[model samples]
Target: MATHLTRRGSIYYLRRRIPLHLTEQYNGKREITRSLGTKSRPEAERLARAISVELDREWQAASEAAAMTAEGKGKPKIDPRYYDLAGAYELAELEEQHAAEVDELHADADRLEKLLAIVERRREQASAGNASKAATISAEARKPRSGAKGNSVSLESVIELWRRDRQPTAKTVDAVTRAVREAGDPDIHAVSRQVVIAMRDKWIEAGNSVATVNKKIGFIRLLLGIAKSRGMIDSNPAEGAELPPPKRAVELRKPYDPEQAEAVMAATAAMQATDPAMYWLPRLARWTGARLNELHQLRVEDVQERDGHPGLLLTNEGEHADGVAMALKNDGSRRWVPLAGPVLGFAMWAKGRTGPLFPAKANKYGNVSDSFSKRYGKLLRNVVKITDKRVTFHSWRHGFADMCRHAGVSAEVRMALMGHAEGGGAAAAYGAGDGLPPAMLIDGIKRINGDSA
Candidate 1:
């Protein structure tokens, strides 16, 4: 049986019919009760449904305790069949739910660990591959032989090397430097044909003559040759580059006839009254078939007058710093050019003592042509119908040589006077002086200047 009471509009229950002493000995002398808070009996009965389940669990626990006590009395005890169906079922279900939650948490941790490992392995492989490729590329780039390594090998370096090793004339060096600086890349091993061709086109567009552009290309070719020899490049790209052929055939500007020569001499003399230096330079060139450079480097000491007989001494100091030694254009140009009569008088009148004979403000031979052209180019062009031609001071040598031929000078004498190499096998074999004697050269000059032999 169970006891029931109503308090605060709620129903309460307590197990009954057991003595207080038995209850204290069997359970713990505490009241076993449950509350069902409701206003009506029906509602209270409905709320007391869970109380019945708690009462059953309490009854079973007490019965188990009494049975264990009886066993301890050393007497055979009867087993009681009792079950707390609600409590047992509810506890079993809670344990199952806890186990399921633990299993799900463990599976999630394992999946995340595997994903992290895969990502780490992929990153390592990618890094190693990139490192290997970088190393290979670096090695290949360094293997090729190039001009003086590092960033310092620049266009300036190329120009400096040309200046030091090629020993080019100042004009030649300046022209080459200008072209190289303007047309080539400093880091590139050799200049490309495309770059050179483009430069050619640009020069032509800028109103430069084909001959001038060709000359510039010639310097670029020389630079490429040096670069190739040094293993800076595998090949010379400019080797196959095309340039415009020289314009105005060489034969068009033929030698002057005797009458034309006389007229030129008269024209030159008449122009002397205004510009003496300009006038005398061409006169001396006509009298002596000397190259423009030879005349520019002529000195007062080189001109010696012995017994009223004048002769020019040609010296070859073999590439001097100062223009003291007379280095001929080639081996054939090493011979002395004899001076006499008007030519001798002209040389003496130009320079009295130890200095350049035909010294211009700029002593270089290249500038002398420019100086002459600026002053008398139009005048000469008006006098002669010299069209579509680039004429320099050296044309006077051709004029003088042609004049000698027309004046009936022998071929041998002409060759000797012009310092040309003799072609005869015997003279070449014996190393005989192929040049004329000083007296004969003086006699030849006199003949050309309208004097008797």
Candidate 2:
């Protein structure tokens, strides 16, 4: 039979009347009905075709049940609970279809008269344990999640709350906001697992890396988990989204040789007359082995004494002049990096300022490492003629690490100084020296400096 659409209130439903021949054997029900769950007529029409296919499958099941009845061949006694459930779905379908009609089904009649309770319990049973496992096995599973779908918060509101409370980077907050807005901005509860899978596919098609795609998906999952914790969504849509296999690590950038390093340091001297931020940032990175953002975000106050020797404090806890927030990449990234001999000279050059030492290079996110990065890129490529893309500003940090390695510094000492994460096992937990001594860091730098000279 051809499927048809009918509206009860604003929601469209899929309905197909049972043929005369089947009505007598099919529990005397004259029509098959299910909520299309959407008001859009076009979407409802497309969904009607799927419900019609479901109705065909139900007809096959009913035919088998009827044959068993006719031959008296199947299980002799059927459980009343089974038919009771069908009655529940049937009654709810009836009520939604006839909402304008009488409201006199007495509460004393039966507990299942609460049709919503039965439907909800059935949904819970379907989703309890193995179903979650099944969802993991498949690329996508879209079904009625276990929660009250009646009340839902908007996806945009959830993102705003997450950003405010979670305090991710401005760049990170922007990326997540853009990605969610791109994913159609449905209510948080309405975002099914299939939607998350589709987003993964869309990002892959647009040429994002496996790492980037996974990170974006991770952000979505993390946000949904927050929503779930607050009872806004029943489940996280991004829980089992697939990711590409891990990519092989590539070493794309290398530090300058002694001659190249000496030339770059000399160029910074000429630049100091025009722009001290440009001059000092690269020079500090050369000696201290700090990330560009770490150096760029430093306040004058960050340069202070460590064990009677000058050191640069790299941390997220500083009280900036404008009070813009800051964060380190990880916990280990917060430490006091001792200034070497060359850096002590720059420290004396940069003392007595209460604000950022590189205020001119600062931007809205609190660090304009990009400004310095671009400026240095030109110097390295156009002027110094080191055409390799790998040997940019970051290469100076690499140059320091290489110096540490060539000086036979211990792995743990290098890691601690660089603010890398604690290494694996009991070693990371138990082997606690407060930090590397200033003299060691100085020694590592002096060897490199002497070589360049």
Candidate 3:
């Protein structure tokens, strides 16, 4: 066998011993082992067999090249008319290098056939005394010719364009830039499949989650795609280089129960009494089902009347007052959530505030949502003492939806109130109406409060 399949815990790897002669040339390297990127033994074996064949071809070509390079070996006979013995020797060495390159790249058979035909023609010239033709070919091979412009796509340029255009948070963009830099920031087109796979493996070895590593791969593809579209590179090397699915399943956040909901409200009220305006965030998120940062980053003017009804508006419009430019998570996130019940007091309090309603938390992460998420999770775990790991701040959104469903709120009203995407036939219902009135949204909010209203 050219190579063997080895199991590392559950996953399989392809392992091949390096040839003895080339081992020294590789600085004492002994084996080449690669993860087959599969957990199924059968699939791993199938992938292994194909890769093993490629490795054998590579090693055979290397061995032949090494033998030809041996001192006083494979000497060519001189025939001055057709070709000089010196030129034949040089051509032999070049052919050896070309063969090894073809094996390494797994180039098409037709390309290898073309290289062989060139070698045969050179040999015929040496035998039949075609010195001028042989010399011309050799000289041309040595001359420098302009190739494609892929190499000009610089690492710095891709990074700049991605940061400027994509507008990811500082934490996200900086992490992506750091990963690319750690990968040595190769030219965009030069990031071959092998290089990208190795980079992903490095992340896995460093204990990064599969999801996080996948996002990194996405960033690499996105950055390189930008360069390719502008003709800077031949293609995006990172395209289609996705890793296998993770072993673990994704866990969804669970909803807060009624007692737990009451505890949260009590916490908010305590904070509100001493809370001033700071305590209003929970109430606003509860009443409107708006995101934590959506409420946290609100300006005084965000309080507006839509369709002649008073409500709090959630918009992707950035920089409430020439502040940091913030965008919504997606198009579905931008909508007007009606404000009512306890949230009315909070809106009245912010009627004329010039700056952000919660400036302190908003400025911390350049991502107030992220900062609030951590603090809220800690509040639930440490203070509120809710031990359910599945529940988090995101669960409040689910709780609102649950309340709307239990209260028999029309699907259209529920989707409109929570900014959820209306799907299928239900979308027409929303369009058929002028808009959801604040009174209807208040009824739903009151249902969430268990008729305390």
| TM-score for each model | 0.50, 0.55, 0.54
lDDT of 3 by residue, 176-201 (tens): 77666545466564556566676666
lDDT of 2 by residue, 333-399 (tens): 7767767677678778768566777664345455547687788789888877888777878888898
Model 2 TM-score? 0.55
Off by over 4 Å in 1: 1-156, 186-190, 244-254, 257-260, 270-279, 305-309, 314-335, 340-344, 347-359, 363-373, 382-392, 403-453
Rank by TM-score (best first)? 2, 3, 1
> To one decimal, what is the Cα RMSD in angstroms of model 1 from the true structure?
47.3
Q: Report lDDT (CA) for all predictions.
A: 0.55, 0.66, 0.64
Model 2 regions more than 4 Å off: 1-143, 146-150, 153-155, 187-193, 207-211, 227-263, 317-332, 352-355, 423-453
For 1-453, candidate 1 gives per-residue lDDT tens digits of: 112333321222322233333456546553444444222233334445556566667777777887788789876633442235445544654565456446646865997698558745654665554445433433332343444333424433566666555444545665776666445333334234545566666556657777778777777777766766776666765675656566644653444445655655677776555666566666667678777556655667766563467666544432222322344454556555667466666655645555665555433432333455555556556775444344545667787777787778777777777776667432532111234566666666677777844
For TM-score, candidate 1 versus 3, the one ahead is 3
- Pairs in steric clash, model 2: none
lDDT score for residue 401 of model 1: 79
Q: If the candidates were sorted by their lDDT against the true structure, best first, what order would they fall in?
A: 2, 3, 1
Pitting candidate 1 against candidate 3, the one with the higher lDDT is: 3
